[model samples]
Target: MQNTSHLLMIRPVKFSFNEQTAVNNAFQQNDTNNNVAEMAAREFDAFAQKLQANGVDVTIVEDTPEPYTPDSIFPNNWISFHEDGNIILYPMFAVNRRAERKPHVLKAIEKKFRIQNKIDLTALEANHQFLEGTGSMVLDRDHKIAYACLSPRTHMSALNNFAEKTGFTTVAFHANDRNGLPIYHTNVMMCVADQFVVVCMESITDENEKKLVRDAIHKTDKSIILISFHQMEHFAGNMLQVQNNRGEKLLIMSTQAYESLTADQIKILENYNRIIHSSLNTIETNGGGSARCMLAEVFLPVQQTQ
Candidate 1:
């Protein structure tokens, strides 16, 4: 299936602006007026309901309170479920995020879907290397390509390891934030969909690297929608393509990202799929993640009804 209607979202018990992640993620802001954790819960609830109402099969799980992992809501960072019955656990840069990986979550998922193999990359974190799953690498599943940008949170060794295990060819580049610091996550600057790739090509300053990435996308027959750095900062590239229960293609994003689009951009995207966005001001302001981060698509086969 090209699009997965099933999505996994973590209902945060203690969601707050993560200071550790903020060092690299410029999108986050610390707000004192808003009760951040409570606000996040409400936003999450609404987001989940919105998705469900749109005919998406949403699985909402409450985060365990004991660990106090604030960023646990972004489960796509620590784990990814593949259509091939493969589950990948990735290495996280933040120490607290490492705790987000829970065996119990896997157990919970296994009850609903079969897992044929498990690939663990968390051990690389011990060596101070990290690759925060989908956040770090945007998978072009149809083309067997992993589009990644090098950053502190995305180590080359870990990327290579993932490519080898997943049988994906990697198109890697260096991406920087406004101040020239490495962008925290690749998904923040680019998204690879089945027929198109949304990217901030200007962020890859080196001509050779930019050409390589452009060529890779071209080879896969994907039309490129390039965004400016300012637009990327607005979370324009952080979009996910999903399917509804009726198998209708929907493009999911934050309201901010939706508004950031130019009329032409929207027209281009509408040609491929329907747009679905929610106001995630609270989530994006404090969580440093948008709609793509909030959804961890579950590609495992549906379990038989007993």
Candidate 2:
């Protein structure tokens, strides 16, 4: 299956704008208007409930309160599950984010799912190299391609290693924020769906790189939904497609992202799937990650019925 109905989300016990992550992620700010941790917990709880109400099977886990890892709610950045029964654990740039990769979580998941192989890329962090999982690279599963934009948090070496291990082609490009600094995460500017790709092509200043990325998407027979740098900044491209309980396709995004869409864009997307969104103002304001970043799809098949 290209998408999963099952999703894993962490309820933030201590969520806030991580000062450590803000070094690379300029989108985050330490502000009092959004009382950091309290607001995040409320938003996360609402977001999870919204997903579940939409018929999504969400596995909610409470984040440990002691360590105070603010970004723990966005679990997709730390781990990903594959259909081949493989699980890949990624190296996180933030010190607290590294703590999000707990063995107990995987063990808990193992009780319901079969994990054939486990690949750990956190070792790269020891060498000062990092790749923040789905945040760093958008995977085109059917085509076996990993679309990534080189940034401070996304290391090229780690991307290459992932490509080699997964037998995926890497389409790496440089993307910058409005101020021209490298964007912290690729998912913030792009998303790869089964038959479509939404991206901020303008972020790639290099003509050659932009063309290469465009050509790669075209080669996959996927329709390109282009979003301007301005739209991308509003988290328009940061969307995820998932299956609902009735086996229906649903595209999930933040309410901010939904409002940013044009009538034509919404119509085009609706042709592919149902759209589901929720108000994540506090989460987006503090965490600098939207709905897509919070979900880690479990593509592994369920155990057979007796």
- lDDT against the true structure, per candidate, is 0.89, 0.87
Q: For each candidate, what TM-score against the reference?
A: 0.97, 0.96
Q: Each candidate: how many clashes?
A: 0, 0
Residue-wise C-alpha lDDT for candidate 1, range 1-306, written one tens digit per residue: 446998988889988888888877888888785688888788888889989999999887889997889998899999999999898999998888888887677777877888888899889988988999999999888778888999989999999999989899998899887788788899999988778889999989889999999999899888999998888888998999999999898999988999999999999999999999988888888878899999898998878888
Runs of candidate 2 with Cα error greater than 4 angstroms are: 304-306
> In candidate 2, residue 74 scores what lDDT?
92
Please report the TM-score between candidate 1 and the true structure: 0.97
Pick by TM-score: which candidate is best? Answer: 1
Error of 1 at 32 (Å): 1.5
Q: Could you report the Cα RMSD, in angstroms, for every candidate shown?
A: 1.1, 1.4
What pairs collide in candidate 1? none
Model 2, range 1-306, lDDT digits (tens) per residue?
568899988888878778888888866766677466777777778888888898999888778877667788899899999999999999888887888987667876786778899998989998888988899999888888888999878899999999889998999999887799998999989988888999988888999999999999999889999888778877897899998899989999999999999999999999999999888888887788899999998887666655
